[model samples]
Target: MKRVFNKFLIQPKIVLSIFLLTSLIVLISALLEYNQSKKEINKLMENQSHTLLDAILISSNDAIKSYNLIKSEINQRLLNNAIFIKYLYENNLLTNSKLTQIAKENELFRINVFSKNGSRLFSSHPLSKFEQTFQNKSKEILKEIFNGEVDTLQIGIKESQLSNSYRYVVAVAAKDRSAIVINIDANKLVELRKESGFGPLLKKFTQNKNIIYLIFQNENGIIAASGNFKDLDDLNSSSFLQKSFNEEKFYSRIFETDSISVFESVNALIINNSKLGIIRLGLSTEPLDQIAQKIINRTIIQSIFLLVFGVITFSFLFIRQNYDSLSKKFRSIETYFKNIFDNVSDSIILFSNKLNIEAVNNSALELFNSKDKYELELNFNSFFVDLIKIDFTILEKEISINDQTKFLLISKTIFNDEAISNKFIFVIKDITHQKIIEKQNIRNQQLSALSDLSSSVAHEIRNPLNAIATITQQIGKDFTVNENENEFKQLTKIVYKEVKRINSIIESFLKFARPLPINTESFSLKEFFMQLKLQYQNIFNEKNILFNIQLNKDTQVKWDKFQIKQVFINLIENSIDAVNNNGTISVFAHEIDNKIEIKFSDTGKGIQEDILDKIFNIYFTTKNNGNGLGLSIVQKIINEHNGLINVTSKINNGTTFTLILPKVVEVKNV
Candidate 1:
């Protein structure tokens, strides 16, 4: 029973098919839900916009009517006062000064008495020029008043074109062939409209953060505004606002400014059968956008949950329905294959004719460090491209994955059976440890031969070099020459210098060939960097070069401190030589993957690409005075410590050297 259940559970094709179907259904459902949600949100926003616009329009109409009523009361009061004052003046109870006093008390701007014969009788205006203009305009109004045979008082309101202010005029005929006129200031009406009409309403609506602005405009330009009044001109000139006004209906539009998005709703402010102006209310659509995003997010999350649940439910039902008949037939076949596959040490992979991975055994999964066959199939092309390109029956190569190098021996065989024809079976065996041992053995043999040769050559050449140097120096000292023999003395001096140079070269070669002892000690990397900085500070200062060091933390690393210091010293000196004045050098240290990584980067003349590979070879120096053993010895020491050294350089840009060493060194006595 367990075997049959396992066979049903392990069929990847069935699980995959069910997962794909569920995902398709979930995706379609999620898309439909998202579309429906978007439509609902849009409808809600549109309705809100209409509702807001209607409220603003209603409030604005009331405000306008209130303003007009105030103006009418002011006009009637001024007219009645003018008529009473004329009656008093005609009865000799008031004089010009008294009339001026009355006008001042009433807050009237000007007072003029015009005769019925179209002549100015008296004026209280300080400016004679304005009084004359008023007199000229009053004559025409009096003619209309007398010719019409109207009632006691004639009142009218007019706007002053020069000052952009309103004036209330009242003319009263007193049956004495003369009329008295009073001019009342009407500018306060506009101020009252601004302060009480639109200000409070806009302030109330704009308390919400999303409301960007509210404005009321007429033919006379913006009469009232609220919220961000800095760019009123820009708002007025926007295409959205113009569209609203041109349509003269409740219209809403969205526009983008430099800083934010604005949604504007424009409604006509109509009162008493006239369109006064437009009341524009601007709101930020960010909240609406957030609503839509939340809907989408919820839909996606629900869809994912549904997909998972559906796949699981369907897969169980499918397995339960097909379990009985498949059990007997597949159990035997599965057991036979599972026994062979699990018992084998070598990894086995079966690929279809189209080069898609069909099956992988337990060993293959373990070899690739994968949880299942799917992971290996996904990474197979990148990890095994070299093996795939080879057309041999049996192949062997070294490859690296996740920083672990491995040597693989691969063998392929074709099967021509009816069900699995043109398919291939690959057997892969890991030989990494064995290959490392073999390479180490070969390296040891080469090093042994080189050490022997270097010892023999150094022993033979050092004695001759010393003897020659002594003889040349003795000749230079004993055979003191006059000016005529100066040439001979110079030649002896040159010979001595050459002999000393040859001896130095021999010493460097011996150092390269010999194995050095390593004293492994745990030391703080921070302290090590501090010592290096103190040692090289003077050199850096003299050259005007900046040196910087960065570290993740003060970590303890166990390694041969002397050898590693030597390696860095050589690299830093080389960098110093390569740089011009006022260059920069930086050192960085960090730990990753159980290894301590150190980097030395310099802004200096870089190495040529052609010779970069050969820099680690012995006696291959680009410098005129270089013995070329510095880097070669550095490489050898690093290899002995089981570390890696790499270099990258670009012409004129600079160079960087990276060294990776084991974080922990075993305490072993040599």
Candidate 2:
């Protein structure tokens, strides 16, 4: 009882796993607490920093609004002046002096009127100021209004070419599609922008004790910076800063210098629809560092405790595992055998004493070409229905399925398993291919011996046949013909014919005795079959036979065309002889496993099972007129091509000959 209980107990690995998992949880809990506390502190700092950045951004927004407001007021003033000038021109009270007077009254820098064609009809400045140009200043400046693309255009704030000052230019369309242009000195507005920009914001944030520096900088240099700002890495040299600007994302990290460390936040700055540069705000990290030092001291103590506990616990598990190693090794060995049982190439089926299938390996399933155990069991029982009669010592047998025979080596043994009193194991190997090779070797030996024997026999027979033919010819020519002349001539003719027939037989024997050279070439079986059908159409028609060539797919094979043709011709001639009127002879071909399978089936008086095995033997014939060499030669040719021939027949049903030929003929003894 104790031994059985021990066998059923939990394994050492699982127990160790539980203990290790508990330890891991404790360690992870400690680390997570520390991380959560750190994250809380970081969260607080992030909230504060975010508030500060938002305030800076709000200030930038306010500045943008202020700058836009100032420009809007200037644009309105210039537009009103241009409208007044247009009113005068429409009233027919407009002249060069009128334009000049309007410019002076409005304190405008320049004013000009252009026709739809950009010809200057009026100008507030003297024409001498524009004389060096075409009929007007470059029309591109007011091209929108001149080309009637827009009624008004504010050509705002361009530096003056003649003076170092700037100009605020505007244009409006008047009567006849002429354009009225106006401008003013833009220096005062530019000064207003300078007073309300990012500079003040940068200076304002630098007042905080935490802020080490704050600046707005671009690729060239700093656009605006606080008075106490410190320079560190530049955009060209700092990929971190470049990433922040390029991705337009907010980023912050610790910035270390020889003197101090700071948490710096960076992001691109944009105001008034213009990307000015990046805003960099560096805050002192003294507070975060002081807290981090305290957390580190506590973490170090906790980590040391975990390391000591892990070492002690691991030592305990190590000793426990030593005691458990024997059982683990046994289990692993069992598993190894199980894997081998399933994966080995020989099919293995385990049966109970009652012959019920208890287990089958992967190879067993594959051997029977089944998907599951149920189907496999059924097939096994059906295929081996004579299993009880099988001699316990018989190691090899042949089984045919689908008119195809396979040689299997079956090994059966009985063993006493722990759970089952008697278990039968059948290990099977499909040795059909090996059997074919062995048979081929034997056939080659037989053919070689026969070739030699036939050579000797042919020499013996031909000498007598030649002498008899000469003597008979001399008798028919030299003997005197009396009243029995006709009878005498007929007898000589019979002698001559017998001699000729014997010679023909000897010639065929000699031909079979010699090696037939193969001329191999690639050809399409589909085309070859089609040609046969066409060439034999008249014969098939006369016999009223339905000759059908059914090809699964077009297959190209490299073979000796002449020899392969003889093989087919022999089969076809037999089919023609066997079939009666209105019978069907069909040729079928498909590719399988790189081999060409050709089937010749005929609806005819089928071969008897007893005689089927002897059909390919030399001089074996069922027909009276046949010399019986056709099928023997056919088998020889097929064997030479490294092919197999099988025949299936049922009396009065049909006979089908299946040929398994290699796509490429192989050189061999046969």
Candidate 3:
């Protein structure tokens, strides 16, 4: 019997018949079981959700009722008290109990008493005296109460994770001018009714079929009293809460691992105009598994009973059959080709030039610097810069790298009018270091050419400038003094003044052409500033402008003192030129965060916004008789020392010029 059954299992026709029959039975069983399980889960979830909605309605009604009663009690006491009544008519102190009594009765926190005349007479809580009552939104609601529009207004305080003291305010005003406010804890009802069955429910479902169940409240949609879901941190505190007050229903559909969660939302109407809350319940696949298990157990028992009869009927017919050897050979060939394609060192992306990756290798990930094949789909256009040797418009046929000619070979074999495989093989090689070196060489050459041109031109201009200055001085001395000669003297003075301007321009050219050589050594900035103060003391006194220097005593820098001094001198002169007679020029030097900063600021007319960008440009000026090369030269000197300069100015306010130089270690001259 065993041999007969073995032969029947090995036979092709008998095996095919058995497999098809088993598949058909399983499919029908699974479908019926799934539908029944789903229905049961949905019913259980909906019942629980409705219960949560009922809780919200009850809570809201309770809060509203509590608010109205508190307001009534406060008004009754105010109306009865002679002093309070008189105080409402006139200004006087009523007992603090007038506010405290209502606060205590309703389990309130604070009570504020506002007079009908808009004056805040007393408050149960000690608050800021100057707090603007009318400026706040709550005050508008309070105003309506004072006008006898509402018996009491109930207001819920917001939730803040940082604070535990939740609050609600109740306001009341009678025909009398006096008003009373009572505060209550807003979170009290929510805390009292939070159901804790959600955790166990989620665990049971997850164990059964890896599904999650969540519950939501109408008052707080995602505040599932019991569930494994994360908090509804996405809900806006004010607007989301207000949505419950406005909308009747909303739903959400979400997918989780091995399950789908359909959120069915409905208002929990406990009574007319009263809400308990919203409940969101989840149905999962756990019930489906239980039903399926039962079905499988039943099917197995039935299959065993039929196996005896079936084995006898089919056994003799299948005993003489032979197996095919071709199936094994084909499977082996398929696996061998697959292994070669997957293990190649370079990515063997054999696409039809339509650029779909048909075959990819394990090494393709490393070669393309990616972890997933999807990362490569964005095409060369996205990540080409990181891998390719050059950037040229894609449709260009041939590309050259470092003047080396490389042909982009496309396959000539045709499949329909397209190239055979329509495949183009292009390889990328790294040239980053070589490219960087080439750029540096080009920049150096350009700078060298500019320096040579500046030097030759400066020397040529200086010789002519000297001759012109000497002639102007000689011509001035040739004139004499008298009443008639006074007019001629003034004319020569004008010529000398203009000639002096030309000499200033030539001096700027010399400064730029021959930069001051740095004499780097340790220098005390504090001591340097003290010397500068002494030198400029008379100038400050004459102008009546305070000249102040603030230097850090501990600060020292290894720099060319003369060159840096020249830079400071130009900046200080510019500051002086900006300031009025009584204005101040402040110079500050300090070591800040490992950098040495020197700031020169003046309280004078600042640079205009339209011209600030031009201030650093060569040979640009805003001042009359100004050469404009001072700041340009200052920037050049700072750059040579590996420093940066910045200026901040507000027209009519003042201007500040800051020079930041990298701090250097001073070598001990032992």
Candidate 4:
């Protein structure tokens, strides 16, 4: 019993489990605290918004009263001026200059006089442009004035003119139905309303800066605005303000910009039994945000303090009880496995039957060219596919990764232990380079045997072919033929032509059997391609094909100039034959990773896929007259230069041949 108890006490997993449980409790507590604080702050802000709306309503009411008082005073002043102007025009003391002097003295916008029949007789300014319209509009105000309602002439504000300035028209009636009309500038009245009413009230109420903006607007548009006038102008046509205005009630909403949160309140301003306008106030909620941040900060501090205290207490107790034994055992086990994992050459990946990677050693990471174990696990299926079966024995397969075709000898086995069960253990071995070398060796042996056989046959055939050609030519030159014997002479000519063709075939075979020795030298690729372009210019022109060469820079490569030139010439000739009129061929050369890569792309009839692999075989020809030795020789020369050649083609689309050659070469004396 004591031993069992001691084992349980010393187990590190128990301590870890307790720590995790404690951390979970702390996280839950923090979340609850944060949510509760947010709810409380939101409730408080809602109440504050109500109070702020009430304050804005009271302030805006006072401002509207002030506006009404200023409007009444302005109206009275305009009526008195109109009555005085009517008295002067009735007495006939209002000459043109006197009317203009009176207009200037009173600082009126304009003044006009009408005859007893409501026709304009005279004016301080030009009346021809507006006299008819003014008389037509003043008929109503003239009726009111002539009715003598309350014995005081009154002025009424009109809508803005084309100049966007307000106009006020006042009419005063005389005994003969004659009246004087005056137009007063209402822009000054607007200035007075702003200075005495909304402007001062807004300034006084929003002194705290929390009320960031205040605006007063009537049916005539924005009359007074303060604090971010541009923002107020933007809200002039807001749906929220329109709804509040239509409903004639106070409405509140929250608006947020990139930097600040604003609680906006809209209320109708009613004074003297009429709605003056709606008042809008934008109150910043930055203080409430500050309160929320403080709550979160306080909760975090308390949580961290508790967590640290608990950790310190548990660590002290654990160290006093079991530190030495656990440390020694852990170090021993870690070192034991680390040395084995690091020293092994083969990559070893341990995964589950579900193909999820459990662990990877150093070799496995390096083999996959990865930095993390999780990355390998996530992309495990990409590296190996269709790996479903796992038994006690190992299975091997090849896979490709990152566009590189590699030979991987994979083995799978089951791992059954206490911590894990039915897990897969994969051991991968790369054998791509070895496979290539083996195939190259086999091909080299075959080529060597074929070369020897072809050499012997070509040598034997060349002598007989030369002798036959000489005899046929000599017979043709020595004998004379008549009209009946013309057929005989034609047959001799055919014999000589056949002999020459056979000799040419034998010469090709001999050259294939033993190629010319490579004389290596360094030459500029730019100049070399330039010369080649010049050589092929006429051929391209005859075929109506375009040829282009793109070079990144001047590059020098040590190669046999004659052999490489022959390779390019053969490729170009094939390209020319493959294309018809208006085709294009392009050559590109650049240096990458200390190697020169050259690509020849042609817009021509491309080779089919099925026969592309066999194109380099001896005696294989796609064309009736082709000898099938050109590409084979090109391949041989490139191989001798220690380069790689590959082709990609699509039928009817085009073909591209890529050659990668070493920039520097070292030739050994043979």
Candidate 5:
């Protein structure tokens, strides 16, 4: 029984099992907390959106009241003034600027005097020369004003500039059949409506994140305000706006979009016995996603931390509780914990709930500049404060510690319930390394796919090009000299030149996709270039371009001699293409720090900046008659040799290509 008890107490598996169980419990608690918070936030947003819509309706009511008072004054003036009656009898309405001035002083956008029959006689806005109709749409307001059913009424007409915008008016009919109309600026009304919706305060709260508040008006929705304008235009549709126009009260709904979860609410606006509009407030789910990720991360970290602590505690107890009890069992337990520490992908750290750094493993030490685990003997929270110096509460969510993203997946649990309530475990994982590896893998995949396509395309094009070259050569040779023969010869020569260029393009593509086999042999750089200089001597002389070769004595590298020669030939040819009549091309090779370095520079019209990055990308060329594969093939050859190649160029100045190949360490066959 004692033996079995000791096995249970000292085993690493039991300790790790406890850690796993604790992680599961903490994760469950975090999930519950997150769900509860989300529900509460959603409810609050719904209430707020409804309140905003209600306010818009109230504003609309106040506008109607002001319209009615103006109409009553117009009716009284028509009955009292004989001159006004005469003016109305001769013309449909009066166009006196003094009357229009009175309305303009009140901040109205437009004012028009119309006859009882609705013909516009006066307008405050500049009327278009071709326009024959007025913008006012509320004929009901005009009918009531003329018939004395209502003293006055507000009418809105859609403006021509905006598809659904309304030009608001307060119309009053005079006793002489003349009508006075006051136009309210739609923009000003919208601004007042948005301000009344409690948006300014809500916007202040969400300035740091994404939130959108909307109001529905006359079967159309308007985004009164938004904290984030990522998808602001979505509110322009009539269907989305009209849905909440009939709702009597407020309600909330959640919608999932391509990237965000939107929490939405609808609330009605009723003012002065008229339903004006509805309001909706939306909160994006990005924050909730971040919160969920935080919880999961914390659970994983805490579980791993607890497992490590348990292993250490069990091992120490086994050593102290009579060394002979289970010495072999303790060793195995220690090794098991060591394997977990070494093999885990993310770096691991254990911090007590008080936020003290208790222990760190090898991975953590290497990442955080600690020589050993014992060197990490500082309060975790205090260490974070000293390093980053940000507010702890804000740092708790997203924190960067010493160039490493120390994502804290944290969990809290009481050990005995009284003195250690602050006790918690934290797991720190380095996501930077993982991201770097992922990026490299993606780049490799892209290059490989492009290379495979280039190979097939090159093969398909080169065979047809060879046939064209043969046909051109045959046509040139078989033609006899005569008046028509001269024209035929020139045609064949042009065809031959084009075919050769095509063949050159195909060869470069093949080189990029399938590198020539390397027959590695030690060769002196001085002798190799000497042969190249002699071979290309006549071509350089004919072009009148200076060809300079600089070589360091006894410089050697292991590479296929022919392949390296081809690399130089392609580079030199490009330099010639870029050069003016007397431009200079210089080639230099040397032994530098256990590697062979080669540089080819040209004093030619330099490459443009926009095309620099694309120089090595397949099918990217600046030359009209050029195949864009030269630099791509150069990069492929350098990569095959386990070397680095880079180019720099400046427009109208020069271009230089640098190649560095590592020294080969030979493995001798026995």
Candidate 6:
């Protein structure tokens, strides 16, 4: 079995290929993981930027509202002062002292009274030696007040000629169709808004390195910006800019370039229901890219380790399972050879040089009538007269066992084995049955000639016996004797009686010369067994032998019942003669494979191997006072019924006779 496994070996190249394939898979997985992580980081950063930009837009709108509210307060205070000056002058109570006092107390830059012809009639302080003041710049603003179209006018904040001052102005109509104007100095308020407005906050947030650019831009130009984002598309020229401004909502998106990746958060600034501009804040993705690279490196390292471990584990398992498969195939081959060795018809013996039997099959045991194989020894040299060597030579010879002769064809061959230098396989075939069949053919020819001779003799003798009978009948009817009549009658009667007996003998010969035909019919074997039991029970009891009959009640055979009954009787009587007290005879019958089977077993002095072939030969009898016709007739009856019979015997072990017959018998002409 080990030798069988040597031819096939597992290949190592397949393992190498698989390992390489798995490594490729791990590498691809690492790359995919890197790309996915990078995308997630980009999304997270874009969302954060959007939140920041939205907060800044809200704060900027509030700042614009606060600046407007302060300017409104200054304008309202100036209108009140202008109306008070108009009231005093119209009632003829106007004077320089009152104008100077108004300027000092109301924090006014200056106050002037202008006549309808655009001439300043009164001033809070008289013109300086080298300075002159101008009237209100827009005539439309003053025309309504001077022409009595409106009683007052408001002028929002304006830059003063003085570098640090701003002004809030107002006017009212005077009684003589003149305008009274007033203005306040607003320099301190301008300083306060510059310090706390949204401009400083935008500049402060842009100082972070991650925030690449922040800008407030509209269709006209950039209103304000922190950080250097030089290239920008205006609201009208850029679709995205225009959309964001019109929506007045936050919008975020990512951009990738050769050097770096950036995401921008955009929003429109709306103050008092007015769209000022859209703010764009750009955030850099350098930090997220670094984190994604770390994830990729970690994944690659872990996958490499797993690839190596998997290759090692797979190699180990493949080697073990491959070896197991080889071993099983070897075992299967050994079993196949062993099966053939056991079932072969010839006696096969494995022996050594010294005629010691190392192993033997079932046929070999049966040939030697051995129950235990170990007890048997090879008798190769003793069986033949010649100095036969255990080589590849065939010999046909006659051997005797248990005092009966048998024909055997012997052959042998040598095999290679380390333990046994000269291991020979000896084959022995029993050819006794063939020899007997050859002899039975010759004997049958002789019997046919003898039957013909009997038929011819009976015909020749029958003619004379008939003539003599007729003559004696005539004498008895026509002739009479004179002296001693009783003696004459007695002598004639004796002659007639002797002739009649001769005719009877001739008729018996004719009957034997022509064979009798069998009358076949269907019969239940169970009922047959019952009748056989009743008939043979006493005879078996006389010898104290055990008899067992087993059969199915429905078993039926189409055969000549009378002829089969005689066959059973012959077998039973033979068993009785062979066995001693406490011996056993068992019969088992059934139907199998569409045929009837009957097994007759006996624990009697079993028949010798050599004489088994001659048991059915005509005139061959082993028992005293036996005519040797019983078994011969049985064989003939079975042949006529188109059946078969087989026999196996072992010395002191018992004999089993197996009879098989067809279910349907073909009848012959009577």
Model 3: lowest-lDDT 10 consecutive positions: 405-414
Model 5: residue 352 alpha-carbon error in angstroms:
41
TM-score of each: 0.40, 0.61, 0.28, 0.43, 0.28, 0.40
* Residue 418, candidate 5: alpha-carbon lDDT: 75
Q: Score residue 42 of candidate 3 by CA lDDT.
A: 55
Count of backbone collisions within predicted model 1: 0
lDDT of 2 by residue, 132-251 (tens): 353456576667776768998877887765668777777889987788878788988877777776777677779888888888899998878884555588888999999988887777
For candidate 5, give the lDDT.
Answer: 0.61
Candidate 5 lDDT by residue in tens digits, 484-541: 8878898899999999988876776666666446667887787887787788778778
**Candidate 6, residues 1-670: lDDT per residue as tens digits?**
5554543344467666766887887788777877777777777776778788877877787777777787777777787788789889888788888899989987787788888877778888886431143554435558887677888787656676646568667788887789887877767677768855656867888999998878887788887788767655677897777777887767777675445567788888888878777888988877776787788778878887878787778768666866788689899998998999989999988866676667789998888776755555533435422423534478777776664457888887777788757667778899976765555555455555655786899999999888988888778767899998888877778888999998986775575457647788998888887898789888778878888988875787788899789878888888887777789999998888878889888898899989987787655798888866677767666666767666667789787777778877778747
User: After superposition, which runs of candidate 6 have C-alpha atoms over 4 Å from their true positions?
Assistant: 1-347, 358-409, 414-420, 429-457, 468-502, 513-518, 536-554, 569-635, 644-660, 668-670
lDDT of 4 by residue, 1-670 (tens): 8689678876889989988899889879998989998888767766676677667776566766777877777777777887787677777677877778888998887887776456676678876445566677656656655455534455666655456777776667764666777777888767666665667877776677787877878767777767764534333467787788778876777777546678777877776668777887777888877888898899889899978987989777765665666678799999998888767888888767566776788888877777888877666655543564433255555554653446767777766868767776778777765654454444445556777888998888888888888888898889877675788888999999988888887777777888557679999999999999899898888888999999999998898899899999988988888887789999999999999989998899998989876665667789889888787787777777777776667688778887888898655434
lDDT score, candidate 3, position 285: 44
Q: What is the full ranking by lDDT, best candidate first?
A: 2, 1, 6, 4, 5, 3
Give all candidates' CA lDDT scores: 0.77, 0.80, 0.57, 0.75, 0.61, 0.76
Candidate 2 stretches greater than 4 Å from native: 1-117, 120-230, 235-324, 382-391, 481-483, 524-556, 572-606, 623-626, 648-662, 666-670
Task: Assess candidate 4 and give its lDDT.
Answer: 0.75
Model 5 earns a TM-score of 0.28
lDDT of each residue in 1-670, candidate 3, tens digit only: 8678566568678676875675566556556655665666556555654564445444545645655565455444433442333444344544567556645664556656676666666665565422244213445657676666765555545443335645555555634746655555557543432322333432333352333444445544554444355544323354533454357553322334334443333443333455545444344545545666775676666555455545565455344332323456677898998898677543444444454544446655555555566665553333332223343323223333322222332222213334354443333323333443343344334434544666777678767767876776677687566666767767777877887786676565555666456658787887777777687778778889898888765587777677678788887778777885888988888887878988788898998978875676566887798866777767667766667666767777788877778777332222
Which RMSD values do the candidates have, in order? 19.5, 10.3, 23.3, 16.9, 29.6, 31.8
Model 1 lDDT per residue over 1-670, tens place: 9778778676889678767877897899899989898878767776797798788887777777787788778768877887778677777786678778887887788887767776766666654665666667766767656555754454556677557787767676765557777777767776676666677878888887888888888757887778864455433566656666667777766767657777777777778877777787788889878988998899988997887777669757766655655675698888997899877999998877767787888988887888887888787655554455567798887666543446898898878768767777889999875664464445445556776788889999999889999999999888866675889988999999989988987887687677778889899998998898889999999999888899999999989999889998998899889886799998999999889988889999899989987787667899999977787777777777877777777788788887778898663448
